[model samples]
Target: MAEFVEVAKTSEIPAGGAKVVEVNGKKIAIFHVDGEFYAIDDTCSHEDASLAAGTVDGTEVMCPLHGARFDLKTGKNLSLPAVFPVQSYALKIENGVIYIQV
Candidate 1:
């Protein structure tokens, strides 16, 4: 089983927002949507843009570099320029702290 690493607290990211965190030296994006938390690879599949800096609309985030949209729940590439989906990670919350397994 993959070990879950505590990355940040729930208050660190607002609802419908995301934060960038390093897990094992890999950049990961932690998102807070509605009342749920999700995680995914921070790098865009088509370009080197940081998804954590992208804009979030519901469960989808738009790549700031090329406007490529990706589904946070599944890391599916939902627009052009990105032919492959980014990686998605497992997440959990305990005592208001967010943990990720990449």
Candidate 2:
């Protein structure tokens, strides 16, 4: 089983926003959408853009570099230019802390 590590506090990510956190030297993007939290790899599959710096719209995040869109909830590439989907990590919430299983 993968280990769950506390990545950030719930308050750290504002609603309808995303945050980039380093876990075990790996960059992970955490998003807060519609009162739910989703975790995914920070790097854009199409380029070197950081998804955490991208715009968060509902459950989808747009790549800031080439405008590739990804579904934060399922790690699905929803637009062109990104043929591969970014990796997504399991997430759990405990008391107000967000934990990610990597």
Candidate 3:
């Protein structure tokens, strides 16, 4: 069974901010938006770019490289140049800490 790994604290990521963490040796991007948290693969599916550095709009992120957009909730590619979807992780919060299932 997959286990949930502690990634970050709620305070570590402010609203409309993002952080990159390695869980089970894979880089995952954690986002805090509108008082909620979301997690997805840190790498962009379109290019060799970091999604953590992308722009967050609502619940989606626009890739900084080629402008590929991805839905933070489902990791679905929302724009062009990205033919595949990045992996989305299950995230849960307890107290003030964030956990990502891996």
lDDT of 3: 0.94
**Clashing residue pairs in candidate 1, if any?**
none
> How high is the CA lDDT of each candidate model?
0.93, 0.92, 0.94
Compared with the true structure, model 2 gives a TM-score of: 0.95
Per-model TM values vs. the true structure = 0.95, 0.95, 0.97
Best by lDDT: 3
Can you give the lDDT of residue 88 in candidate 2? 93
Name model 2 segments beyond 4 Å from true: none
RMSD of each: 0.9, 0.9, 0.6
Best by TM-score: 3
lDDT of 1 by residue, 1-102 (tens): 688899999999998788999988899999899999989999999979999999999899999999999999999999998999999988889999999885
Q: What is the lDDT for 101 in model 3? A: 92
Per-residue lDDT for 1-102 in model 3, tens only?
999989999999989999999977889999999998999999999878999999999999999999999999999998899999999999899999999899
Give the true-structure RMSD of model 3. Answer: 0.6
